[model samples]
Target chain A: MKTVIIKYNAGNVSSVSFALERIGINALISENAEEIKSADKIIFPGVGEAGSAMNYLRQNKLDEVIHSLTQPILGICLGMQLMCNYSEEGKTNCLGIFDQNVKLFPLSELKVPQVGWNTITDLKTNLFSGIIENEYQYLVHSYYVELSAYTIAQTNYGISFSSALNKNNFYGVQFHPERSGAAGQKILENFIKL
Target chain B: MLSKRIISCLDIKDGRTVKGVNFENIIDAGDPVELAIAYAQQGIDELVFLDITASNEKRKILVDLVSRISRQVNIPFTVGGGISSVEDVSVLLNSGADKVSINSAAVKDPGLLKKMAGQFGSQCIVVAIDTKFENNDWWVYINGGQINTGIKAVDWAKKITELGAGEILLTSMNNDGTKKGFAVNITKQISEAVNIPVIASGGAGTMQHFKEIFISGKADAALAASIFHYKEIEVLELKKYLKNNNLEIRI
Candidate 1:
């Protein structure tokens, strides 16, 4: 199966590519529309500000291309947030693939920019197939998507939020599976099998 | 729930892992690639490689080492020591380092922090502040805690974050290798002063110390060298202890 990682003005592309390489799959990193569209599976991975990233996607017309991808697409971290309708990080209008809206972590006793590893519970999708219900995954994000009907996995930080989302061919995760060790590797392997 | 992090810091010298106290009494730990794989199997939250050598020749070794480790390990790794410019940050990031930490170089050129953040994004940039307690103030140190920058740790932390630093790795030189616990007051000050994530480094000998840092210091992560390197406290056991203490952890 062919996999293409949508590349733009974002970080962590190489790491995701490296993750795929570890699983014996060589993924093409491209920003070209035809290249991404032709792939059997598409992966949208990003680590950067929301507004500028969306601007880059729109500038290159990848925004529309991403929304129209019929094959399974996995978005990681900011990639997952950008797949939503809107983002509070930079007041960004995203691809609107999922019905959820990304908002900043509520300013409360809990810390902003939740870092380190956290266990994901209430997993309820095929993306989490074979993975335990409460497996630990690495995460680092200042903004998060509130729990909605599409939420596949839930995690609580200050308040509970969607740790993973599933909507048709589109799938997203707030945690970095590429960096979450064995459990993370299993998630990626499962995504690849899909 | 948010899980506490267990980070193992490897001080790299001539492309090898070295362990010591207060940045002295260097002893050979092992090969960087081998140790990194072991840590990955243990399910470490993160790995930090601090290049102790400060020469042009050693940096090339560090670069090659980073590339090898990035290929071998599937977790996030942060590289520090002698990172001076955007070019250096790019080289390390391109070599598979998830984040590039700026310590002495950032103090010398604060603009580099902004430049790196602009090029690689804020999440890839980490500002490591080495602080020493003096006159009841946490003062930033330079050159591996050899020179005092005279900059208060809290003030400098705010400055770096404003410059778009994604996180802060604050190390208390006085408490390092002492195994007493984290410098809670120093960690709390910096953690409260910045909106970004603060990682408390130094003075963790036991799993309880990790709990203390999270509860009392309010640090997002606790980074230690000896406790993890010498097997004094296993990362898995540490996570278990933190979870039992009402601290969220991945177990």
Candidate 2:
């Protein structure tokens, strides 16, 4: 099966491609709309800031291309944040695919970036088919999507937030499944099988 | 809940895992990539590969090693050692390293942390501070804990966070190689002073040490090298022990 990872000006795309390689899937990293549209499955992987990322997506018109894709597509970390309706980070508007807004975690005793491992619970989508509840996932993000109707999985860091979102064929995860261990690999496998 | 992380650090010299006692009397451990895979399978929360290779080919060798680990291992890892510029950080991150830890380079030029964080978000930038307790307060050191920077550890931790560091790797020169436990006092000082997560490094002898660092030290993560390399304590056992102690670990 053909899987295309949408290439943009974001970081960590290489790791996702490498993670796919470990699972025996040689996905193509391309920014070409034609290659992305023709793929049987599309993966939108991202790291870095939301404002500049949106600027890059809009400049290359990949925003429109992503909105038009019907294949099973996965958005990861910053890619998942970009799929929301809006983000408090840089006050930028997002792709609005999940009907949710990404928010910066409130200033508290806890760290800002929320680096390291956190558990993902309330799994309700095929993206986490075999993954057990309270499974630890690697997360490093300050912004999170609030628990919404589209939230497929939830995690708490002082307060509960959406760790994963799903709508139709679109899937989004705030954690890096590529960086997470075996549980994360299983999630990727389930996503591929879908 | 966000779990306290247990990170296994590998000192890479010429692409081989090497362990030095207090930065001296080096001993070869094993292949870094193989050790990394084993650590990942042991359910370690994260890995940090400190590139201690002091050759001109350090960058190339470290990059290749990082790419290999990223392909074979399925856990988050941070790469550090002699990274000074934005170009170095870009090269390592582009090569699939999840994070780049800056130690002496960040001390030499504090602006490096701000610039790197602005260019590539704060989450990916980790500032490693090597400090030793002296004259009634802990002071910062550079050049692998040989040269004292005369700066207070607490003040430096706060400064780096303001400069856009998302995490702090607080290594206690006094506690390192002691195998007594972590420097809980200074670790708690830095952890409470900074808004970013603090990773307690240097001294770790038992699973109880991990528990103390997480609970009393208030550290977000704990990192160790020798105990893990020599198989003094199995990672899975340590994790299970920490979990049994109710430390909220990933086991």
By lDDT, the best candidate is 2
Give a tens-digit lDDT track for model 1, residues B79-183: 998888888988888777989899988999898888888767777889999999999898999988999999999999999988989899999998998999889
Deviating ranges (above 4 Å) for candidate 1: B20-29
Model 2 per-residue lDDT tens digits across residues A76-173: 99999999989888999989998888888886756899988899999997788878999999999998899988999999998899999999999999
Q: Residue B5, candidate 2: how far off, in angstroms?
A: 0.8
Candidate 2, residues B37-94: lDDT per residue as tens digits? 7777778889999888887665798899888988888899999999999999999999
Clashing residue pairs, candidate 1? A156-B1
DockQ of each candidate, alpha-carbon based: 0.57, 0.88
lDDT of 1 by residue, A5-114 (tens): 99898878878988888899899999999999999999999888899999999999999999889999999999999999999877888989898899888755656667
Native-referenced Cα lDDT, model 2: 0.90
Best candidate (score: DockQ)? 2
Q: How well is candidate 2 docked (DockQ)?
A: 0.88
